[model samples]
Target: MMNDCSLVVGGSKGIGLEIAKLFSERGDVTYILSRNKGKWLGNHIEADLSNERNLNHVLHYIRNNKIRFKYIVFAQKNRSLPDDLDYELMIQLKSVKILVEGIAPSMEGGAFVFIGSPSGRFIVREQPLGYHLSKAALEHLTKYYAVNLGKFGIRFNCILPGTVLKESNREFYQANEDVSNLLKRITPLRMFGEAMDIVNAVDFFSSEKSRYITGQVIFIDGGQSLEGQESLARRLTFGED
Candidate 1:
C-alpha cells in the first residue's frame, strides 16, 4: 500500500523534479534531494552525492523523527562525459545504498527504485565506460537487495532510460540538426521522452500498484532498443511492458 512521506534522492531537478511533483500532488510528504538549495514545491534536502556523512545524517533524521515512508526512489542522475572519466562511478551507487539502508528499517514493505541508464543494459560507448559499469553493478545490487528485502515485503527495481534529454543535452540536440534527425529516426517513437515519463513509472511501481512486483529493470526508451533500431524498417519493441 502507498503511504505518506516518500524520499526521492536526486529529486531536485530534471527527471527527479517530475517525480517530486507527482508525489506531492498525491498528498505524499515527498522529500527531494539535491546538493544545491532552491525553492521547490516539495521539501528539499541539500547534500552532495559524494558526501557519505551527509547521506547518513539525512537518514538519521528520518529515523529519529519516526517518519515512516512507502517509497524510496533513487533517480540520482549523473552523466559521465567522455572527458569526465576521473569520476568514481561506484560512489553514486554506494551513496544511494547508504540512504536506503537507513530508511529500510522504517519502511512498511515498500518499493526501492534505482534510476539506471539503458547503456548499462545494452550497447555502451567506449567513452562512458565507468558510467556503464556502475549501472551494470547497480542492477546486481538491486537484485541482491530485492532478495533480502523480500522478507520485509519491500521491492527493488531499476529503470534504464535511453537518451534522456537533460537541460544541457536538450539544448545541444535541438541546435544540432544532424544529431537530432538521426536520433528521432532511430527511435520508434520518433521523439525524445520527457522526465515525467520516468517519474510516472516510478510512482506506479512504488505505490500499492506494484506490490507484487520486484527485482525488475524497466526501460523508459520509446522502442529505441527494438530489434530493428536502425535507419531502416520498423523496430521490434523492448522493455517495461
Candidate 2:
C-alpha cells in the first residue's frame, strides 16, 4: 500500500483541510490530524501538536494503522503574538520539530509539502507579529529538512500565500482595505486564491510531477508580494494602526 495513504497534520480547516480533501479526492486514503475536531469537514485525530506525549501517540496511530504513504502534507501555523520571545519560540518550535521528527523516519520516499505564508519572506511593513517571525523560522526549517532528507528520497517544500482568503481571513480582509485592493491589481490571475489553489500545488508535489522539486517555497499569492510591504497597510484605519 505504498503511495496509497497520505497524512495531513492540522487538516481540519483552512488550507490544511483543503489539502486533506485533495488527497482524498485523488484516491489517497487521507488521515487528517488535529488536536480538536473543530468545524472543518474531515476525519481527524484528537491530539495536540504542541504536546510531546501526543506526538508519541500519533506515531502509534500511524504504525498501528499500517499506513504507508507517498505524501505527508503539513499545514500548521503558530498563531501567537506574545510579548516574550521565549514563549513564542516554544510554540513555533513545538509544531515544526515534533512533526518533522514524527513524519521523517516513518514515511520514506514520500513528498512532504508544507503550507507556508508570505510573512516569512517580505516583512509585511505592517504585520510584525511574532507569528510572521515564526513563519520565517519555518521557511529555514523547510530548507534544512530538505537538505538532510534528500538522500532518503524525501522532498520538503512549502507554499507561501499572500492572502489566503477564507472564513478565517474574512475579518483580516475587512480590516485591511488597501491590502485587499492591492491584491486585486497585482496578482496576474487577478483574483483571490481559494483553498483549492494551495491544494493543487501540494497535489503536484505529492505526485510524480514534482519529484525533482524540493526545499522550494512556491508563492501562491499571485503577484501580491510584488506589491511590496506597502500592501501590509492597505486597509488599516487610524485606530487599528
Candidate 3:
C-alpha cells in the first residue's frame, strides 16, 4: 500500500521475478526490464542486458515517464558460463552499472539491491570462472557506489543467496543429488532456501525499516558461506598433513 515506484531488472524469471511480484502485490508501480516478458501480468520493458543501447532506452523511458524510483533491484541470473569475458561482464555487471547510474539521479533516497552470490565473496572453484569473477567485481562495485552515492541518500547493498530453489533451477537441483545433499549437509539450516526467502530480504531493505543500513553485503545463504570456508580450510590442513 506504500506509494513507491520500483524498477526490477531481469524480472522475467527466478529471483528477479519474485522480487517484482512482491512489489506488484504491495501495489507499487513495478516496471520489469528484461529481454523476455514473463508470465507475470505487470508492467514490463523488454531490454537485453547485453545491449547497451537497449539499456539506454530503458533509462530514457524511465526519465521521460518521470518514474521516481523508491526501489531498484538488480537480480539478473547467469545460468550458463560464457566463453567471452566481455559478454559475461556486460550481462552480470556493466548493464547494471549503467542502469544504476542512469536511474540513481532520479531516486528520492531509495534503496538499490543487487542479488549477488556467495561466490563473489569467497573462492568457489566449482562455479564458472566468469560468473565468479563478475560477481566478485559486482560486489566491490556495490560498495563503491554506496560510498560515492551516500551523499544523495541512495542506499546500495548486496544480498548473496545460497541455493535458492526456483522454477528454473528445480531441474538442476533434482539432477545433481550429490551437490544438493552436500549443500544441505554443510548449511546450518540443513535446507535449501526458497525464492521467498530472498524476497523477504529485499522487502526489508526496500522499506524504511532498514533506513540506516547501506554499503553492506548481507548473505542470505543459511550459513553456507561459512561452511564452505571451513571445508576449504580443512582440505588445506589435511593436505599439509
Query: Who wins the TM-score comparison?
Result: 3
Candidate 1 local Cα displacement, residue 130, angstroms: 2.5
Task: Give the worst 10-residue stretch by lDDT in candidate 1.
Answer: 232-241
lDDT of 1 by residue, 17-53 (tens): 7787888888888888777634466677776777678
| C-alpha lDDT score of every prediction, in listed order | 0.76, 0.74, 0.85
Candidate 1 achieves a global lDDT of 0.76
The C-alpha local distance difference test score for the whole of candidate 3 amounts to 0.85
Write down the TM-score for model 2: 0.81
Q: What is the TM-score (0 to 1) of candidate 3?
A: 0.89
Candidate 1 segments exceeding 4 Å error: 1-3, 79-87, 228-241
Off by over 4 Å in 3: 79-81, 172-179, 228-241
Candidates 2 and 3, the one with greater TM-score: 3
lDDT winner among the candidates? 3
RMSD of candidate 3 to the truth, in angstroms, is 3.5
lDDT of 2 by residue, 78-97 (tens): 45445545545555656667
Residue clash pairs of candidate 3: none
- In model 2, where is the ten-residue run with the lowest total lDDT? 232-241
Q: Considering TM-score, which of the candidate structures 1 and 2 is the better prediction for this target?
A: 1
